[model samples]
Target: MVPDPDLQLQMVIKALSETVSTAVDPGNKVAQEQLHLSIATLGMMRSRLPMTRRFYRALAQDALTLAKDLEEKTGQSGALTQAMNDVGQALTDPGIENEAIEQSRARLHEAITDHLAQIDKSLGTVARDIVMQGSLGSIERQRAWFVESGFEPNADRIPAISELIQTPDHP
Candidate 1:
């Protein structure tokens, strides 16, 4: 059978922790930064296992290397907050089965779809306002700004803003 990705992630975090712990100079800034970046990028990934704590919280609680970028992104920690709420609610439900979890996943999927649609619509309105207010570069720049604003524009970000640039509505 294929190994679970969440287990793989756990192994990774363990490896990172061991490596950092055994480093000849634990205080090295570069090593710390690499650790931080890895943890930050891993922050958005949810666990397939129900038992895991959100990554940053675990790191903080365990006194592991803290991710600076992840910290910056989670100013109010809404993603982490939502994660805690979702998982907490799921785990606490004594009657929850895989089937129930699947249903929850389906609902979450629909919620995500609706949320993205709303964002797209809001962006459309913003684009119109930008044009009415006078600008030729609104959409192109918005896409660039998305990339700049800590979004992985190339990875998993669908209908990439870069792709959207060629569409008429954006211009």
Candidate 2:
């Protein structure tokens, strides 16, 4: 999307490195620094995302609560657009070699996804938990849906959660 904001990503990593992971890993400290910076930059940009009142209700809650509270703010589009500019610039940070950062990012995602695939913990979708919990109260709705089809609302929840965990987060 948006022609791969390479520099912006680097900037964002440079921004976030300070907060996400700052350990002295054996693998490329320079890369780590750049990544952290980039993430921090993006986090800062994300702060301007309007933070709608709907979301405010769940501001102190966990991810699931937050997502469920999304009534969609009215004036966030401008903020998101500005954030894109910040992301673009961050992706193109010159402090860290852009080409090397790209390569490392690719490898990193591959490794992370590989690890996620092997994880078998039964934790259903984090952001969807509120919706699922809401459904739990509707036993009649569950039964009716079950009767109409060969699906059960109580089925396959853990697997769903595990997959949700696989979704990447900068933090």
**lDDT, residue 120, candidate 1:** 45
Deviating ranges (above 4 Å) for candidate 2: 1-95, 127-171
Give the per-residue lDDT of model 2 (tens digit) for 1-171.
653555565555654565446554649878776765556556544442332221211211222222222212111233333333333333345464444444443343343234334433442243234335533423332243233232556553323222222223211
**What local lDDT does model 1 show for residue 64?**
12
Per-model TM-score versus the true fold: 0.27, 0.20
RMSD of 2: 21.1
Clashes of each: 0, 35
Give the RMSD in angstroms, all C-alphas superposed, for model 1: 18.4
In candidate 1 the C-alpha lDDT for residue 104 amounts to 46
Candidate 1 CA-lDDT value = 0.41
